[model samples]
Target: MAEDPESGGEKTEDASSRKLGKARDEGQVAKSVEIPSVFVLMAGVAAMYAFAFYFYQNLMGVFQFNYNFQGVPDFTRLEAIRLLYVHTEKILMTCLPVFGAVYLTALLANFAQVGFVVSWKALEPKPSRLDPINGFKQKFTSRAVVEFLKTLIKVGVVCLVCYYAIKGELTEISRLYDNSTGAILLFILKVSFWIFIKVCLIMIVLAFLDYAYQKWKFLEDQKMTKKEVKDETKQTEGDPMVKSRIRQLQHEAARKRMMADVPEADVVVTNPTRLAVALKYDREEMDAPRVLAKGAGPIAANIRKIARENDVPLVEDKELARNLYSHVDIGKEVPVEYYQAVAELLAYVYGLKNK
Candidate 1:
């Protein structure tokens, strides 16, 4: 079991959807820095390879422009500034492909990890982050150690790959001294490209591993303690005690409303002491008799008291009271099966009133 960093309690449960959503809202998500780095590196290498010819042509033009000056021509301040601006513009244009590739790759890599998230809460500054003691502790944390080791391994692997790659090209490199400058430059570019490609392949594997580890670590960090789960449940579903009270209040209010309708009921059928089902019907206004209220136990006793106070007729019928109380709901017309029984009871009450 992992312990919650904040509460120091055992986090025995997986994070709830609400917890994950809240964390996401705060811009906390599983992501590996290595994934973006590797992607950007690969993009830069691919861009450089594709744009090499274009860059060389532009660079050569610039070099020729610098060196192919006619005799000892004018060299004024304005001319110098103009030459600088032109050179700067050409260089920037030559490097545009690599820059664009890096920028787009970075965006894509990050998007792949966490989609598009913008959280002002994440941008907010926290004073706890400025605590020197906390900062010092963080430096020696397990995560920090893992990051440091990962960096070391990456650097070591890249160096070893570069070493083996160059070693394989030693024979070709040795003969470069005897070749033209252009041939030497071409050989160097080829060797560099191959070396970079090998490094990219290695980094790609590492990036996947890192991404998996990061996701696992993020889930672990988000794990909740049992108490926290209950507390969060209370927050979202309302506290059980409070909910019970609300339900009780609702039942009482409905009962009072039902009691108010007792004075208007044609009759109330009772199981004598156990059940009470108050009914109402009007020949001109109602299609059939309807249960105005029904209750058991204390509510049944209360209904009987209200019926007596309102002078509503009370008809004691064990089987009919049980059926009406069990089957009929308040404000609903009695079913056709009970229509004959209800009509007889209402007729008996009307006869009593006529007397």
Candidate 2:
């Protein structure tokens, strides 16, 4: 059913499991980009800290090698290409592990947020996504406004953190000209690392807030209207009237099967009108007589009619019939207390058969 905004208005109902599942299948789930960005930044910085000595030595060697190079390798094209390749290779070898760690951290962060999700629908090209009108609406949406404000706050916070981090090291920065080249490099590295840590910490807090907001937006978008819930329920579970009719037909079919077994019964014990208990005994199969069938009201009348037509003997015992119907189930042995009463009825029915 089409959702008429003027009629029902906004969706106030909570999202159903089916709705959530459909949304997930379409790759619409709450996930924040900040989580992976934060993790990758953290991993890159941590890796740099852990491998600082190795990186510093290799970097120094590359700088020395570059400084000692003589006359651009005789100005040949092949030599020029070779020089470029060697420089690129050295840089890659030095930075490869750090880049790899950052990539791995991003993958793990995404996995933590939404595990092992693969949806082709998310990657499929949709015209709606390219629609300028829809894009404009989304850009001006309340959620977008909040996200933009959050981004501004994060940038401001990181800038403030960086300022404070460097504020303490102004004197060290001023004395950089007097220090040796290696000492100056080390000082710059330490100051940059301190600023990186401060910015990373501020972003971590912002990432958590962004993640929370993403989840809230996801739920709001997935909410269902009352008619939507009802229609979904009907689709998953058949219409009420149809279900009731099916149950009625099932009852009739079962009643017919029970009536067919009444002919095999040795006797029909009845409360005359309200209850009827039909029991059958097999010496080899049963330890005690079982209730082949029992019924009440109209069903009791049908059982009596079927028994009389089949020429089975009828015994009117109100107490015995009531006890059997109440305490015993169809296809189950009667209660122990009713065994004596049932035995006497069976003996009388057998005597009649013998005559």
Candidate 3:
């Protein structure tokens, strides 16, 4: 006897082919962080300070108490007690908005990237967590290199922005010697500008990094090897042998039920070796002709036997028998397509009963 391909020997080849195809099409590592929201929050902080400074200078002017002498003699206290209140108020204003922007941007970035799924499966303790080999593999991967570069670039950009901001404020600091009060106020403005620029640069860089990581992670997670697909299928659906056995058992049970009900049938329609369907009907009790049993192959042979044993009539119209067997179940009404054939079968049975 020829060996079946699905029995065992050829199964490994099927699994291997599936695994290789999936690996070629879908294997990549995911990124681990949110970058964009951090950047937006940083920008928001900068904007807050800029707006606060603008309001402060316009609302409460700097306090200046002066003492004039021939050769630069004495100095009186230039009380900035009111300026303190303005500065604190500005800081608070800047902080609140920055915080709000950070929060909203974080929410949006998180939503856009991973969606709302909050499963703890990834965080569950596994051997992979402690395995140094896995850690080494991840470290050497392209994903790790990209993350390192991203962080380096972010730091570099912020440092460069701070350096230039301070350079621009040098002249304002120098002018403080001649016009002490005005120069002091200008210095404060310059410092605020420098801080704002630094904050903005950091935020923008972080946001860009976040967006890049999100895209990278999405692509990586979506990757799947052929092997992985097959494995997933096996896990979700059971082994082929087990599935086939279950189907066979279910078919056997159905056949036994149909055979038991065959004697109740008014008529058995047969396509000889291929199909058998036994139908039951009553004019007063039934709205339509109902199939009492149906089968193919050996079950069909058994159905014919049951009908003959009970003295129920057997009809052999190939087309009508096949249609009835295909479309109606053992306990259900015949479908519309088989209505005429079933009605004729029922009429023949009734005439025989009356005779």
Candidate 4:
């Protein structure tokens, strides 16, 4: 029942496929950014967890090389540069699995939300987009306010999750000070992994909710006013009045064509006063007699008048006339059942012509 401000009517009609398709071409789709972000975060965390042993080995090797060198390490510029290059390569290798997982997840999540859309139209520059009044209106819209609130809620949720996570591990955190370096590192990893998992789980729920809201909002935005629906119908299907007029013109053209064929007809079968059917047959060119024209009421009168003027024979056969008018279309041969009757009529007309 929401009213369209521009149309001054309720937006009660569902969007037509034409409008929805146009919106999609312009890169308008109901997709939640949170869905991709949450999936990527989860993927990265899972990748890091799966590659934890590899990370540990790499870190240990770097530590031993730097601090447990048996001899004083080479101090030449070349040696220093080589060490830096080796370390950079090791770091990149260590992070590669996590990066790959995040990248693939981001692509898949977006694909799942909106499929694969490459919209150049959305990227086009428009001066209307730079209008200060519209920009100001957009900033203060309900959607913008809702987005602001969502940000605040996410921050609050993350902080609350971190607080609970740390509180649960307070005893273990206190023991970390007395433990070996390896034990402290292990404890930190365990706590961080659990916290990351909890955040991901919460984000998954939020993402789904946000996606639902986005879809609902998209549909609402696509809703059409009654006037819009009517206008679109006219645009796509042509105005009903114009279409009716075209049909009238077509019917007139076809009638004129039918009347023209009456003069060439060898016989005119009539339902006495109401119906008329004109039939013509050529033994050399046609397998059977075809209806040249058929009509009722005013058209029948017209056909009969033309037949009289053209010296065509008028044969009153009520049943045959009704049968031809009802069952046979113009230009189609008479059916097998009517062949004997029509052949007799054709023979009589040809005999009269001989006299």
Off by over 4 Å in 3: 1-47, 50-144, 181-186, 194-206, 271-274, 335-347
- The numbered model that scores best in TM-score is 2
Each candidate's lDDT (Cα)? 0.90, 0.87, 0.67, 0.91
Candidate 2 lands at a TM-score of 0.92
How much lDDT does candidate 2 score? 0.87
TM-scores, in order shown? 0.91, 0.92, 0.64, 0.89
Candidate 2 residue-wise lDDT, 1-355, digit = tens? 3455843656888899898988888888889999998899899889888888877887777777878776655768997898799989889988988999998999999999988888999999989998999998999988889879988987798788878877888887888889876787677778778877888988898899999989988998788788788888889998888999999999989888888899999899998889999999888999999998899999999999999999988899999999999988888987788889999999999999993
lDDT accuracy of residue 271 in candidate 2: 84
Candidate 2, residue 136: the lDDT equals: 89
Q: Tens digits of per-residue lDDT for model 1 on 195-284?
A: 889999999999999999999999988988988999999999999999999999998899889888988898989989999999999878
Model 1 lDDT, full chain set: 0.90
Worst 10-residue lDDT window for candidate 2 reads 1-10
Model 2, C-alpha of 62: deviation from truth (Å): 2.7
Mark the regions of model 2 whose C-alpha exceeds 4 Å error after superposition.
1-9, 69-73
Superposition error at 218 for model 4 (Å): 0.1
